[model samples]
Target: MRKILVVGAGQSGLQLALGLQSHGYEVTLMSNRTADEIRSGRVMSTQCMFHTALQHERDLQLNFWESQAPKIEGLGVSVAAPGSWAEGPAARAIDWVGKLDGYAQSVDQRVKMAGWMETFAQRGGQLVIHGAAVSDLDYFSRTYDLVLVSAGKGELVSMFGRDASRSPYGEPQRALAVSYVHGLGPRPEHPDYDAVRCNLVPGVGELFIMPTLTTSGRADILFWEGIPGGPLDVFNGVKDPAEHLSLTLELMERFTPWEYARATKVELTDGGGTLVGRYAPTVRNPVGRLPGGGLVLGVADVVVANDPITGQGSNSASKCAASYLASILERGEKEFDEEWMRGTFDRYWDAAQHVTKWTNAMLAPPPEHILNLIGAAGQLQPAADRFANAFNDPADFENFFYEPGKTAAYLASLS
Candidate 1:
């Protein structure tokens, strides 16, 4: 059996490891934290995964929480009108809900990752609990036929140098904060169904109200993507969960009153239900060279770390795992050399490029045509649904989202 070492116990790493194990590969999965530690840790992300990504999990039989997590039937957009902070909810500009062809769902990473770790062990794959460093990889590389780094954080990330041509930003784009809470009431506009509410406070930031399944039970996620140094970028030093939830609601009150009115009674699900941090969107070379001359392949966020403004982090990771799994399976007895590594990443990039382009585009200030596209979605159901489903298949954005001419043409056809 081909021996493989996967460093990182994240969504991508775990999924890939399990897939390889089923294929008769000797897989060793290493994680810095054990299942208990992960289950007891702070919130990692507001991973609202769309259908295609969810399907990837189902194919692997890893969708354990599917029956428990709320099925997000649609996504709604509410743009704060000019000076709406002062004018209140009555001044909201564009308001509409786009029904997704397939429902999306958000299961807290703490819950999902921990459950996956235990599942991996139960399935007979080797689970190693230790923080992996470059030296560790160098030593392990001698034993395993292949080494893959899926952990996007910590020192391992630095080994993969940034691809300057693909990495457009040098500094963080947005100040991100998340709070997982219970008791968030339903959106009155769509009370009958659960939906992902994206409230845009133009020039300030965005508030994503998500219905989620956490460790405790059904909960909601209040995520803020604030432009660096903006007024909403105030969660930097807040450590108290109560304080984080308080500030999250206060911001909602100031920017998205409609959401705040429903969130007034919410409370944190756990003491560790809040997270705050940020990183620039970057694409890195896939192969990392160790000091000892061994090579390791970078996966998921390790190679393409786009800002969460587009909520594509987990989705992209799932796709990366699925893509990489196919490449590895096809390699058949060939050496996992640097050439093969690059080729594999390039194959994954063929699909990932769309996600990278769309996410990077979202980070920047919206151009006139992009603004027009969003505005027109309010009046056109087909346009709204297309835009919402794009969250599941971002490659569709290439059809109309990037070029002003295409955007105009698309809206005209809808009209």
Candidate 2:
């Protein structure tokens, strides 16, 4: 292999570049700008790389946290329905997404991504600061031996062309609002204050709060969701950034009433919020093989894992990279075309579908099993804990993505 050209320099792209380079493959990472742009204290999307993602990093020995990054200890997950009590022994709590003192670490992926890219460059990997440019590649010409497209953006979908059967996605794409803010005006701390949280508030959507080591020294992140073209888009008519944060804080106070009872009210400070308006697309075929040789494909959030309800965006790509890398290393460039990409991705597709479908299923009117299950938990205390922990247990984790039946079975065991 002469050199692998990787498109898109996001988290997924960085991971693939590191993996390939570590395996002694020649790799050139091309992005809109140099890694220095990413290192300029900008955080794009917030991702909780749970233990699995961290293990992948450690396994590759890709650590850049000596000076700036902070290590995350754990995650607190609470699943609450709107208007429900969120505190006390009587209220229900969801399972923690990570094991105690485990490998899950919260990171400003933008910074860490740049650090890894710098490391890649130091290790002799080529860095190309080309913006939206790629030489047309045809395998017969044998231009690069292998061209891996990790492009996580929307336009990349058309690259592999289109296929009907394997790529049927029925859901429409939706816009989301994500912001990292600070000094949200201050709330008194609770007696038992546990920071670093992930929450799912029914009807109101999800928000993940993580501790960040930034210029402000310590900052928090808030990920908010709004219906496309809805009132929230214009910050519900608020004109300025502080006003927007105020509106979000206002809404948060109203909706997070349950959490507000115990958790500290966010104190918003001016100029501390950075908002990214994102449109996430749904995809059943994020991974597709091109018709010719010298090409293999994998889609991360880059391609379309917009189903953030499942948090598979980053993890899916990491797993996909591992799978795609394996496929390429096994079959070599000539054999690593669309077909083999399909074969390796089949495993990823099956795993992701099982969990995401179940997750998205929860958003709508509840299914009978869910109703019965939640109803059962309400009636039987132990059953609820067991049922909710389905998102955490190792067996539940494995089966959640790999075997829905097994996940169902684990839940059934408690009943």
Candidate 3:
């Protein structure tokens, strides 16, 4: 069996490691924390997995929480005018709902990662509970037939140089804050409660109210994407979970009254259910060189870290793992050299490029054409459905989302 070392036990690393082991490869998965530690640790991300990503997990038999997780059946968008953010939801200029082709779901990373780590061990895959650095990877490269880095944090990720040509932003597009709470009541407009509530405050930032499964049970995840140095960038130095919950409620009252109304009695689901941080959306080279001159392949966020503005981080990671797994399986005893690694990354990039572009566009101020598209969606069911379903396979967005001409034509056809 070919020996493989996967550094990082994230969505991509764990998934890839398990997949390889299923195929009879010798896989060693390294994680900084053990399963118990992960379960008790702070929240990792606001990971809302759409249909395609969830299907990938199901195919690998890794969808353990599928039956328990809350189903997001549709997407509801509300656009507030500039100063009208302080007003009530009645002041919103546009409000609409777009039905997804299939449901999406969010599983808290604390619960998901811990469960996946345990599953990996149960499946006979080796699990190492030690943090790895660049120097560590240099040594690992020589011992393993193939070394794949999937951890997106710390010095290990810095080993992969930024690909400036592919990376458009030099700094973080938004200051992100997320809190998982259980006391949120259903939105008055949709009391049945099965949709992602997206609120866009023009020139300020965006807010997403997502249904998620936490360690305790089902809850709502309130995510704030605040434009840096803007009014909504108010989550600095918030260490207490209760304080964080309070601040989130305050922000909601200031920007999204409809959501605020529902979140009036909200409280953090657990001590580890709140997180605040910022990250520049970046694209790094696929291969990293060690201090000792060994090359290791990069996968998922190690190569592409997009801001969660479009909720694409976990989805992108899932797709990357699936693509890389197929490439590795087809190699069939061939050397996993730099050429093979770059080719594999390129294959994943073909699809990831669209996600990056679409996500970046969502982070920036919308152009007139894009605004028109959103406006049209409010009146047209087909346009709304297409926009909602785009989250599933972002690659299809190139056909009608990026080009103003294509968007106009698509809108016209729906009339």
Identify the candidate with maximal lDDT. 1
> How does each model score on lDDT?
0.92, 0.55, 0.89
For all predicted structures, in order, the TM-scores are 0.98, 0.75, 0.98
- Tens digits of lDDT, candidate 2, 59-95: 7776555234445544445555544533421233443
Using TM-score, give the best candidate's number: 1
Error of 1 at 310 (Å): 0.7
Candidate 2: regions farther than 4 A off: 66-103, 133-142, 161-175, 183-198, 213-217, 227-240, 258-273, 278-280, 284-296, 302-304, 332-334, 368-415
Deviation (Å) of 99 in candidate 2: 5.9
Error of 1 at 56 (Å): 0.7
- What is the TM-score ranking, best to worst? 1, 3, 2
* For every candidate, C-alpha RMSD to the true structure in Å: 1.1, 5.3, 1.3
Q: After superposition, how far is residue 211 of candidate 3 from its true place, in Å?
A: 0.4
Candidate 3, residue 282: how far the Cα is off, in Å: 0.6
Looking at model 1, the pairs that clash are none
Give me the runs in candidate 1 sitting further than 4 Å from their true place. Answer: 86-90
Per-residue lDDT for 1-415 in model 1, tens only?
A: 9999999999999999999998999999999999999999989998999999999999999999999999999999988886767645525788999999999999999999999999989989999999998899999999999999999998999999999999889999899999999999989888999999888888888889889999999999999999999988999998888888889888888888888899888889999999999998999999999988999999999999999988899999999999999999999999999999999999999989999899888888889999898899999999889999999999999999999999999999987
Residue pairs with clashing backbones, model 3? none
